[model samples]
Target: MSKKVENLLRDICFRIKVKGREVLKEFPITPAQFDLMQKLYFAGEQTMTELSRMLGIAKSTTTGLVSRLENEGFVERKRRKNDKRIIIVVLTKKGEYVIDKVIFKRIEFVEEVLKDFDNNSKEVLVSLLEKLNNSVKRRGG
Candidate 1:
């Protein structure tokens, strides 16, 4: 039983990583870009510093990512109404559309992966994942 559990864990992790990369190939943006988009989309508009801090990336690296996102029309900078010096990054309509599509595809991939799972198993899987997420946060991942 222990060996079975270990195999299950290893296979689950490896498959998710490989399958995520494989399915993401159809998208124009890299995984990093999608990650940033997700952060911006979920968190709303943020300054470069805010995004950098959230992503745990350097300020200059965030700047380049923002630049590429802007040029690709995935994101745009909006000047703050209160402060002209601070620019808030906002996702454009195109950005939102791409994000939605990418998310749908990713979801489909997950659905495929878990198609054989029973309802109880699915719930357990989600619970375990939540625990894992908490662990990562605790470890400052």
Candidate 2:
């Protein structure tokens, strides 16, 4: 039963990723860049080192990603006011707009897929997923 549940979750995740990539096709940024933007969008501004650590990538790689995002006007690097040496990456309005649209599209896809599910069923599913998510977090996953 656990194995079946794992497989189903994996398959569902894969399908969602495929759909996300399809939605990303309309954007100018690559998936990796979009991921970086998402990190910033949710976590607020972060220093270059912090971004690299959070993304689990090398500083040089993070720099390159930041460069591209900066060039595209999706993000900007700002020097800390007190600590002028530290530079933080900030998401621009353009970046926020892209993130919003991408999330909206993904939600629309999910809505279409769940169109046939009754309200009670949908609520139950959400509750189960939330419980699963909490369990995973407790396990440090």
Candidate 3:
């Protein structure tokens, strides 16, 4: 039962992600860029090393990603105040705008997908998902 539930959850997540990519089709950003931007939007500024670790990618890969984002005016890298060796990245105004639009589009798509659900059903779903999320966090997932 647990394995079935896990598989179902993975399938659901993958579908949602694919739908999100579809929603981003009109935008210049890719899913990878969106994921990185989303993290910055929620997690605030972070060093390149930290971002790489969090994204489970190599430092060089993170640098390449940041380079692309920077070139597109989506993000900017800054040297730490006291430590020039440390590079912290932050989203630019353009980056924020793209992220906001992408998020709104994703939410709109989800609303359409969930339109058949009643308010109570939606609320219950949210509650259950939150519970599961909290449990996952507690278990270090």
Go through the candidates in order and give the clash count of each.
0, 0, 0
lDDT of 3 by residue, 52-119 (tens): 88888898988888899999889999998999998899999988887787667678778898899999
Ranked by lDDT, the better of candidates 1 and 3 is 3
RMSD of 1: 3.9
User: Per-residue lDDT tens digits of candidate 2, residues 1-141?
Assistant: 999999999998878766766767776798889889999999999998999999999999999999999998999999999999989999999999888887787788899999989999999999999999999999999
Model 3 regions lying over 4 Å from their true place: none
lDDT of each: 0.83, 0.91, 0.85
Q: Where does candidate 1 have its weakest 10-residue lDDT segment?
A: 15-24
Which candidate's TM-score is highest?
Answer: 2
Model 2 clashing residue pairs (backbone): none
Models 1 onward score TM values of 0.71, 0.90, 0.87
Model 2 Cα shift for residue 39 (angstroms): 0.8
Runs with alpha carbons beyond 4 Å of true place in candidate 1: 1-27, 123-141
Residue-wise C-alpha lDDT for candidate 1, range 9-72, written one tens digit per residue: 8887666555555645665677787778889888999999999999999989989988998998
lDDT of 3 at 34: 81
- Assess the local accuracy of residue 116 in candidate 2 as a C-alpha lDDT between 0 and 100: 89
TM-score, prediction 1: 0.71
All candidates in order of TM-score, best leading: 2, 3, 1
